[model samples]
Target: MNTGAVLLYHAAQLYCNLYKVTDFQAKETAGIGVYSALSLINHSCYPSVKHYFIGRSLVMRAVRPISAGEELTISYIKPFQKAKKQERKILLQRYWFSCTCEACVNDWPTFPNLPALRFKCLGCKNPLDGRPRVCYACVTKRRDPDKPQTEQMEVVDSIWRGILNACCTDLALNIGQKKTREDYLTVCQNLQLLYEHVAMPCQHVIIMHQLLYKYFEDEF
Candidate 1:
């Protein structure tokens, strides 16, 4: 019946930018927020940056190196928690948009779907997944004389072991041993290294972003 209310309703449908306000310390949902600037950010299944609330204000931080001219993004959904096909469906059904992120386009398996360890290419270190032998990039690189051979994949065994034993690796959160901030930092660092070798949306990378955010929060 109210003219202004009708307009606001339509605008909310088209422009409403909602984000889960989380209290990391409490590990619970604080509420939700809608900021005009943050609203402008587009959704990516694999976001380049992450944002958090600081006393009702928002702080955005980059989790990985960003090249010049690259667009900043954040994930509205937990891409690591769900499978690719289901994640795509959720994004389409809820946001009315399909994700074309590297993970989605390449059909990278989510963290839930990955095994304790994954196989990587002997050349590029890119995840082989189910691909036969080496990936196409490595195959092409073989022809180039300038490109050097990647290290043996077996070298990352320690790194993988670190992740498997990480406090955040399992649901229990390391009940046996107390995890100090330094401990978390070590795990996050190893995760970043693991990320460099695996495919995009790899468990190590996504989980690293999540943990690194919490680590920095504790640091500063």
Candidate 2:
């Protein structure tokens, strides 16, 4: 028999004995006890089969149900932990295909440092110097600039309220209902506007776009 046929035969025989199903056959041998017909099963970054060894006998079980006409798949490696680029490169060489998994595709990007604010002295409204025991102007008046200024507080509270209101309104619209294409598109547009107006520049916009893309793509 050809290599493919041999592998299939072995896989069928092994599957039958392992699962106690009697209808399987091994038609070919591929290496590492992997049979040809079974080797026809493809690799998925996310796989249905859980590959394991039972005392040197290769065993696989369905992690999820397999449907008719669906290609059988097994993972090339562990799912959760992050792997170094070099490690992935070596694995891809062995597998003979480039890894196009979500983890591989979405490598994290660096974020910028936060904006700095000037600290002011309460008594004179002057910028504070480094490590001063007390502001010279504030010491004589027994005033503390560290306390929240009422005007500043009011402005901050108003901005916070506006953001909260927008968020709550969006949640009400989207939650607990089947969203239509128009509804999803509207939400994405709204979110894009809010992020542009409110969030700092150089912030991660890709995450926002990805969230919208996932829902829209799933619809299609």
Candidate 3:
């Protein structure tokens, strides 16, 4: 190849190496290919569409309804995997474009708080009442000295129970050959919420992460 042709070929190869996403299964790399036109799509932490393989062809499916004139977007990164500011800056630097996506602009709360959200308070050993600031005993007790420490637990417990029941129902329905990718994703999403909100360490949290891991292994 001529010098110019060699340079262009190397540039294309580098682009593919850096930007192409892998489609995998069972912890093995299934295949890799470029979606040249789909690469034109912008990114959002909350994307309107999802792109995956249907056999050997790439297909884009709307995860939700879309309206005309809306700019098409796909996520270049996972949700909550990085803090908003850091992710945005990294995207801008890597892609040479600033993200004006709704999630970035609105400063949505990422799952960066999962560790705090998933465990009990260091002090008092009770549930961290809300937002992982401190346990009810450590903070609320000063204000409502007459109120029982378990008072807030009632509301949190009710919410956890409701989520647990819904997840169980969904799991039961999905037990057979009737389950779809969407259903599996839905279950994992709920379990993620349960894990984030349930401040007590429970076996269910481990199960939730396991189910999520299985879904990702099989599908992503």
Candidate 4:
């Protein structure tokens, strides 16, 4: 019998729990025991069942309904990453068979790299070789490119929120009244500018403005 058929038989014998099948019958399958019963379910590049683990237990659920006579299948790994050559080696060594899946047919890369959405500074764009510093050219630019500007604004907004939260909780004031007032005023002014220009005038900015107004009103 093929590796997939053998796995199915083993899964059936273990009452359909791949985890238990692998754990109890590991010596029978060689240390190549299945990580999930779903693993024994055979493989298709496009599979119906999505398998994951709930702690040590292998959990399998239908990604879509299965029809009769269709070989029940699960993914050996993410289809996008499993090149034909690599998959064949794994299946031959571990499952004792060869794989013939659509993913393999297409000659997809064994490890697909995900695309990044952020722009890097022109001077320090290397992914592996730099401790990034603000580039002089970037500083000279009138406006930052979208990605860096978005990141900077996010940091500033987070700091402003932290300051507001501290004021609301009375933590800032408890340290020293003068210091608290100065910090609060600085945060409020910076927040106002960030809200107007950087935060896109979102409702959160309006709410924060209302909160700051109430805080100062009550204090004064």
Best by TM-score: 1
Clashing pairs in 3: none
Where model 4 places Cα greater than 4 Å from the true spot, the runs are: 1-40, 55-57, 64-69, 77-84, 110-220
* Runs with alpha carbons beyond 4 Å of true place in candidate 2: 1-32, 55-57, 64-70, 80-82, 107-220
Look at candidate 1 and tell me the lDDT of residue 117.
Answer: 45
Model 1 C-alpha lDDT per residue in residues 23-133, reported as the tens digit of each score: 755778888777778878987776787788766778887777677999998877765446565756665566768778776776667677655445566566765655353
Range of the 10 consecutive residues with the lowest summed lDDT in candidate 4: 21-30
Cα error, residue 171 of model 2, in Å, equals: 42
Alpha-carbon deviation at 177 in model 4, angstroms: 35
Whole-structure CA lDDT of model 4: 0.47
Superposed model 3: Cα runs more than 4 Å off: 1-27, 80-82, 112-170, 173-176, 180-220
TM-score (C-alpha, index-matched) for candidate 3:
0.48
lDDT (0-100) at residue 103 of candidate 1?
65
For every candidate in turn, the CA RMSD to the true structure comes to: 5.5, 18.2, 9.8, 18.3
On TM-score, who's better, 1 or 3? 1
Candidate 3, residue 94: lDDT: 56
- Per-residue error (Å), model 1, residue 164: 8.1
Candidates 1 and 2, the one with greater TM-score: 1
Between candidates 2 and 3, the one scoring higher on lDDT is 3
